[model samples]
Target: MTDNGPAGGMIGKVAVVTGGGGALGGATATLLAARGASVVVADWNLESAETRAKAIVAAGGTAVAVGGDVADDDAVERIFSTATEAFGGVDIFHNNAAAVHLARSDGPVADLTDEVWDGTMDIGLRGAFLCCRTVIPLMIARGGGAIVNTSSIQALIGDTWVPAYSAAKAGLLSLTRSIATQYGRQGIRCNAVCPGLIPGVRTEPDMLERILRRQPVGRSGRPEDIAEAVAFLASDAAGFITGQALVVDGGLTGHMPTYGDPVTSPLDAPAAR
Candidate 1:
C-alpha cells in the first residue's frame, strides 16, 4: 500500500499526540509525520497546537491541530472524533499531557492534600487512561495500533517533595503492562518512554547544571532524544517491543551512583593522592 519500503513504515498511518504543544511532545509529533504518519497534534492550547501543526505542514508533512484538555472526558472524545473523521482510523496515540506544575500542590505524604492528589492524578494518570480507552476501540476497528505513555524516572526512584507526581507516573507503568498483556492477542501494543533530567524551557541554569552533573552521560536530555524513542515504539520497527519501559535518559538510571568514588579503592585512593 502506502508503505515506502523499510523506513517509511507509517506512510498510511494516523497518529494522535496529546500535549503536542509542549517541547518534547511537539518534537515527537513532527518526527512521526516526517516518517509518513498523518499526525493529530492535540493540546489544551489551541495556538500552540496550531504552531506545531503548521511547522509539520511547512516541512511537507500532514498534520492537524486540535485543542482539548486531556483530563476532560468530553474533550478527549472530541479529539479522537476529529482524528477519525479527518484521518480515517487511528494507528498511534502518544499520551504526553500532564499537569506537571501541579506538583506545587504536592508535598510529603502527611502534607499531601486531597485536592492536590486529585488534580495530579486527574491530569497525569487519568488523562492517559481516557485517551487509551477512546482510542483502543479505534485501533481495534482499524485492526491494530500502538500506544506510547510518557512516564518518568521518578516513578522508579524516590524523589522528594512530589509524592503525587511520583504516584501518577507509577500508575502509567502498570497501565502500560495491563493494556499490553490484555490486548496483545488483538494487536494493540502499549509501551512507555521514561525520561530523566530533561530540563524544561524555564529551567534555571544552576538547576540544569546540577542535573547534568548527576546524569552519568554528562549532558542533559533533549526533546529530540525522546522523540526518536517514541518513533521507534510507534512504528513497525518496534513491532516486537511491547509492554516495556524504555529509559531514554542518557544513562541516568543505568546504575547506582557512587558520587565519583573509585570503585576499586575508596581507601587507597586518598593514600595514593
Candidate 2:
C-alpha cells in the first residue's frame, strides 16, 4: 500500500518469503512486492498466506501464495519449483519462517524436553538449511542471488529459559556465514538480520514495555523496521556486503544494563535523570 514500488531497486527480482502469514513475514513480502519483485509468499497457514497475497494484489503489487512445511524436503522442492515456474527464477530468498512460543517457559538444559528441542530445531535450523540447500543450486543456475536469514538477539545474548531456541538461532547465524563464504564466489550472497524484541501480532503492552526497557531506544521493534533493512540487503546498495550479521535492535544490545539504583546505570545516570 505504501508506494514502495521498486522504482529502481529490485525492479525485476523474484523474491520468496517464508512464513508470510506472520507480521514480520507479511510485511517483508509486501515490501518486496512494493519494490517491484514478483513475490511468492509461502506459509504453513494457507489462509494467511492467501490473505497477504490478496492484500498485495489489491495494493497493486505482484505476489502469489504457496502453502507448505519448510521442514519437509518434498515440500521445499515443490515450493521452489512452483515459484520458479511462476516467476521464471528466484532472485531473493528470505528464510524467515520460525516456530517459537514466547509464552512457554521451557527453561534451561536440565528441564528441556527432547520433543520441544527437536521441534524448534526442525523448524528453525533444519528448515532453513533445507530451504537453502534446495534454493542455492537453483540460484547458481540463475547466475546469482541474495539470501537473508532471520536471526534474533537471542542468538548473540544468552536466554537461559530458551536454550534450544537460542541454540538454533545461533546455528542459523553460523550457517549464514558458511553459506556466504562457500558461495560468494558463485555469485550467491548470504547474510543475516538479527532483530531484538520485535512486537509481533501476539505481543501485548506489558510484554512490549518490558522489552522496550531493555533497549537504549526504549521501544520494541516494528515490522517496517525489519522490512526496510531487508530491502537494503536485497538491493544493489549492499552488493558488497555478505556473510555479515546486521543487528537491528535499536541499540538494545549496545546499551549498558541499568541497576536498581538509578545512579549506577548509564540510562539513569544523575545527569540523565
Candidate 3:
C-alpha cells in the first residue's frame, strides 16, 4: 500500500484479477488500481478478497471483491459478472489462481495421485481456460484488452517435485500462445508471467537457500517483481508484445546446470600468473 505516485496508464480501464487475495495477485490488483483501473479482486477466500479490495479503496483506488473457487464454471461466470456489473466491462484479466497448497500432495509420476493432478489442473489450467473463454468475447466487444497469466519457472525447466504444478503452468504457456495467435487481430493480447522462488507463501528456508545459490541474481523474488511484470503486460506499453512468457525470476532459469557446481565454476579456477 505504499504510495507509488500518480495514477495514469490504466485510467478508465477495468481489470479482473483472480487469486487477488494472495501475494502476487494482491500486488498486481493493487498496482492496477493505483494506475487508475477499477479492479475486481477475486479469490477463493471471500474475506481475503474483501481485505485487498478494502485496502485499495482506502488508498484512494477503485476495487471490489468476489469470492469463489476458480475451478467452478459458475464461480468463474460470477467473477466476470461482478466485473461487468461493477465497472461496466473488463479491459484486463490476470488469470492467477492456482492450487499451490496442494504441492504437498503433488509429486513425481510414480507417487502422484489422480486426485492431486486433477485438483492442480482444475484451478491452474482449467480455471484459466474458463476465464479466457468467457472474457475474450467481452474484450472483443470492448475493442481490445490484455491478459497476463501467472505461470512459473518450472514450466520452462525440469523439477522433481510438484509435477502437477509444473504441468499446469506449462499448459498456461501454451494457452497464452493460443489466445494471442487467435485474438491478435481482434486486439486482445495474452501473455504469461513466470515467477521464480517467491518465498512468502509456503517455501521452506533450506530449499529456498538451495535455489538461491543457483539463481544468477543471488536472491529470492518478491511478489512485487511478478506484479510489475503483470501490470506491464496488461498495459498499453506492452502492445507490441503477445504470446510471450515473461520470466520474472531474477535470472533463475538463465544459467546452466553447472552454474553453482564448484567443479565447473569459473570463480573456482586457478588465478593466472
Candidate 4:
C-alpha cells in the first residue's frame, strides 16, 4: 500500500548519498535533508562533501560529510561505519558514486582501453556492489530500508562512447533485481534510476546538444528530477516498488527510433519543432 503522509517522503530518516559532492548526488542529499532526513554527503572529495553538509546544516537541516574512495572496499566500509556511528542506522542509500574518464568517456566497444574499462567498472559496478553488501544486513537488522542506484540510459542503449560505463550500469540493474529478489520478504527494497542527459560539470554542453537533437522535451534532465525520484523510492510512499528501473528521460526511451514517418517525426517535425 502507498503511504501518504508528510513523513511519507523520507521525513525522520537517515540517508547516505555516495559521491554526494557531484551534481546528482548533491541534489539527492539536499532534497532528502530538506525533507527532514539526516543526510550524509559522502564523497572522495572531502572538502566538497563537507561543504555541502555545512550548507545543509546552515539551512537548518541535519547533515554530515564523510570522505572515501568508492573503488576501495575498506573505504566503503568506513563510510557506512561513519554513518551508523554518527546518525544511527542507514534507512536509505543512494548508491550514486561512479568513475568514468573523460578521455576514454562513453564510446564504442572497440575504443575502450584496459585501464579505462577496468577503472570505470571498478567504481561504477563493483563500488555499487560493495555498498550494497555492507548496507543490506544493517537495513535488514533494522527492519527495512530502500536503496536507489544511479544507472544511465547508456546501459540499455549504445549511442554513447563508454562501453565500460554502459556495461557497469547494466550490472547495477541486475544487482538491483538480485537484492529485491533476495530480501523483499524481509522488507528491503532495491531499485535503479536510469537518468538520461543529466548535466555533468564537464559534459553539460554535449548533454544539452543531445537533448536538443533527440530529447522530446527539448531539454536535459536536472539533478533535482532524479533526486525527487530517489526521495520517493526511499520513502514509504513507494513501499511496494522494488527491482524497478525507472527511466526519467522525458519520454525519450518510450518513442520509436525513427517513428512511423521520418519526415513527420515527432522529434524532427518542422512545425512541432
Q: In terms of TM-score, which candidate is strongest?
A: 3
**Model 1 misplacement above 4 A:** 1-8, 260-273
Tens digit per residue, CA lDDT, model 4, 1-273: 112334365666789999999888999888888888888899999998999999988988889999998889999998999889988899899999998444346466786678788888889999999999999998988898999999989888866566788889999999999999999998899999998877665675755775656667766789998988888888888888999998988767867767434576765666642
As a TM-score, model 1 comes out at: 0.92
User: lDDT, candidate 2, residue 33?
Assistant: 87
Q: Among all windows of ten consecutive residues in candidate 1, which has the lowest summed lDDT? A: 1-10
Model 3 segments beyond 4 Å from truth? Answer: 1-8, 271-273
Instruction: Kindly list the per-residue Cα lDDT of model 3 for residues 181-210, writing each as its tens digit.
Output: 999999999999999989975788899988
The TM-score values for the models, in the order shown, are: 0.92, 0.92, 0.95, 0.90
Determine which window of 10 residues in candidate 4 has minimal summed lDDT: 1-10
- In candidate 4, stretches whose alpha carbon ends up further than 4 angstroms from where it belongs are 1-7, 102-106, 204-207, 259-273
Better of 2 and 4 by TM-score: 2
Residue pairs in steric clash, candidate 3? none
Against the reference, the lDDT scores of all candidates come to 0.88, 0.85, 0.91, 0.85
Error of 2 at 122 (Å): 0.3
**Sorted by lDDT, highest first, which candidate order results?**
3, 1, 2, 4
